[model samples]
Structures are given as C-alpha cells and as structure tokens.
Target: MQDTLHGDSQATGSGQEEGGESPAMDPRLIAEVRQAAAGDRAAFESLIGRYQGEIFRMVYYRTLSRMDAEDITQDVFIKAFRGVETIRDPVMFKPWLYRIALNAVNDFYRKKRLRSIFTLFSGDREEGQAPEEDRASERLERKEFWGWLGKFLTRLSAAEKEVFRLKYLDDLGIREIAEVLGKNESTVKTHLYRAVDKFRCEKELCGFLKEEKP
Candidate 1:
C-alpha cells in the first residue's frame, strides 16, 4: 500500500495542465476535507456523499463483484475518516482518496490469494462449478459489457492496465494518475500509450476506440 502512495509533491495538481478531463475538486469539497480533518462528522459524511458512487464504480470495475465493491467502498471512507489529517494538501483530495482506494483493492487481492491457498490446503474448493452471479437480470446488458471489458483488460500488463483504467475509465488526467499510482508522468504516459496500442489490435475494442474518437 505504501508503494501506491509514494510520489513527490510535483506530481500533484488539479486543472487543465494536469490533463484531467474531469474538473478539479470543488472549492466546497476542499473546505469539507479541511473540516473533516478537524474532526467534524457532518463534514466527513458530506464528503462521503459526494464521492461514494465514483468510489464504488472504481472498485466494481476492478473486482467485478457487487458485494466486494460495496464492502471495500465502505472501508475506504472509514480509512479516510481516520487518516484525513495526514493529507498535506486539501486540493489534492481526490487523488489522495483514490490512493487509499487503490490500497484497499490491493489488500482485497492479498486476502483473496490467502483464501485460495487455504482452500487448496483444505481440499474444500468447489470444482467445475460457476460462481453465483449476484447481478440482477435487469442489469444484464451492463454486466455483459463489463465481462467483455474485463477480458480485454487482461491483455494489458499490470502497469498498462492501471494507467488505462485511471486515464479512461476513471477520467483522471496524466498528472493525477501519476500521483495516484506513485509514478512519474513519463512512466504513466508510456503505459497509457502501450495500452492504447494493444487495444487497437483487438477487433472487439476497435469500435469502442472509433466511438471515442473526437
């Protein structure tokens, strides 16, 4: 988790120069973070209300499990409430919060790996059985799209995958992504370029690329 939070202050920014399509954090959000850090419960809850959906979507894209995403999203806010004071710049709140989220996702994968090991040792695994689908039939179209996207993502290297998701799915700018992933801007761009080249080779994603063209 520390590895995901190790960038220098030079990587932090929140405007056009950052390459972020999304607007910078609202001035109101900056004030809310400051108040929350001062131990105001309402301020912290307001912060949660402001970003919960985006955080949940980030987790869901990575985990593809509704229950796991919800659980992790709650954990993220709890962790943030406890550690908000550690944040040096209130304007960097979104990237800092995303760093916490990325850490939570990493922890989830670690625990899942441990569970797999335990299941192997105990011979308790259910073989040749599909995992139960938790999504509703009404959301089948969305689920199918994510299913295909997940497969496409696997084709990217881990670094490329992270960059691609942050830049495209999360709508983060180059500098914001650099801060969140603790990478330099050049390294982030390299990964994004490679990921795009790989995506161009996939027939299924070609239409997506075309549709996204400006």
Candidate 2:
C-alpha cells in the first residue's frame, strides 16, 4: 500500500515510458474476472482481495480521509460486482475497476460541493497506532511528497491532472488511462504531454527529485 502510494513522481513527466498499450493480463486473473462476472461470489471476493489495498490507497490519495476512502472502496467493489457482467473484455477489468473508482471519487467531491462544504477530508490516522521505526522516515517523506504534488496538481487542467495522476502516480499505462477516462490514446497522450511539460519546469520539484535519486 505504501509502495503504491509512494509511486515514482519522476515517472509522471517521463514521456511514453508506459507504452501505448496495456500490458497483457495474467490468464488466471482474467479467468477470475470472467467467473466473477458470471455471478460467482467467491470469485468476486477474490477480485476484491487482489485489488482492495491499491484501491484503498488510491481513494485515500484523492479524499485524504481514511474513513471516506474505506467507504468508497467498499462502494467501488459493490458497484463493480453489480456491473461486472457488462464488461466485454475480461482483460479490461483493471481499468474498468479504476473507471468506477475515478467516478466514485468525482461523485464524492460533487456531493460535497453540492452541500456547500468548504472543508475537505480530515486525513487523520487511527489513534494509538504508530508506524514501525524502519518505515517512519519513509512515510513522512512520502507524505511530504504528496503534499507538494497536490499543490502542483492545482496548476493543471482537470484533464491534464487526472492523466498525470493515473499515469505516474497510479502507474497506469496509456491505454489503461484512456480506458479509465473514456478518452482515446492520442488524447491521453496529449494531456500527459502538457502535464509533463509543466512538471519539468517546476524547479523546486525537480530539485527534490534529484535528492530522491538513489
């Protein structure tokens, strides 16, 4: 989960690294998606286990609220379960799931805006639990990175920001991002190109990336 959350920020602006196509799906995972789509409860639960951690992390990154992330994660699976049979290509299950998640996050924000709420998520961790000593520093650094990245994302258009996050932060391939966003490959690339162009010019973030190099 931490690894997913702390994805390579430098990768965001590195053009075409993920290739134009999605990587081939594992046959077994494809089978699982197919079975789940056929109403097999166990298969659906298996899908949940496989993706829940990353889904939770993705949601947490967007909402910054542990509770909201948990609820949305559950809702994502519920919605997926209900609609799995509509999926034409089992190989597309991953991106399809992400599409659901991205929609759910957008809906979350929309509802908040509708209610005229100015304050966002609390982002608090559970009380009385401490991170392991070995991971503490890494967690703090990643937290700081997210804070900076969040600020930077505000400069991008909605399309550019979403493309950048899905590509670099969430490690989606271009085809997968297109599938998730309902855009074409070229459009995805265009948004990514614009985002990366801006990202490269961010001097402070570039300096931080240099320090982050191994």
Per-model TM values vs. the true structure: 0.80, 0.80
lDDT of each residue in 1-214, candidate 1, tens digit only: 0012222323223324434444667788889999988889999899998888778778877886666888999999999999987877887788888999999999999998888898998988743222335323345645556666888999999999999998877767888788899999899999999998887788776675566558
Which 10 successive residues of model 1 have the least lDDT summed?
A: 1-10
The TM-score obtained by model 2 is 0.80
Local distance difference test, per candidate?
A: 0.78, 0.81
In candidate 2, how many Å is residue 120 off? 12
Candidate 1 local lDDT, residue 40: 90
RMSD of 1: 8.0
True-structure Cα RMSD, model 2 = 5.5
* Candidate 1 global lDDT: 0.78
C-alpha-based local distance difference test score of model 2: 0.81
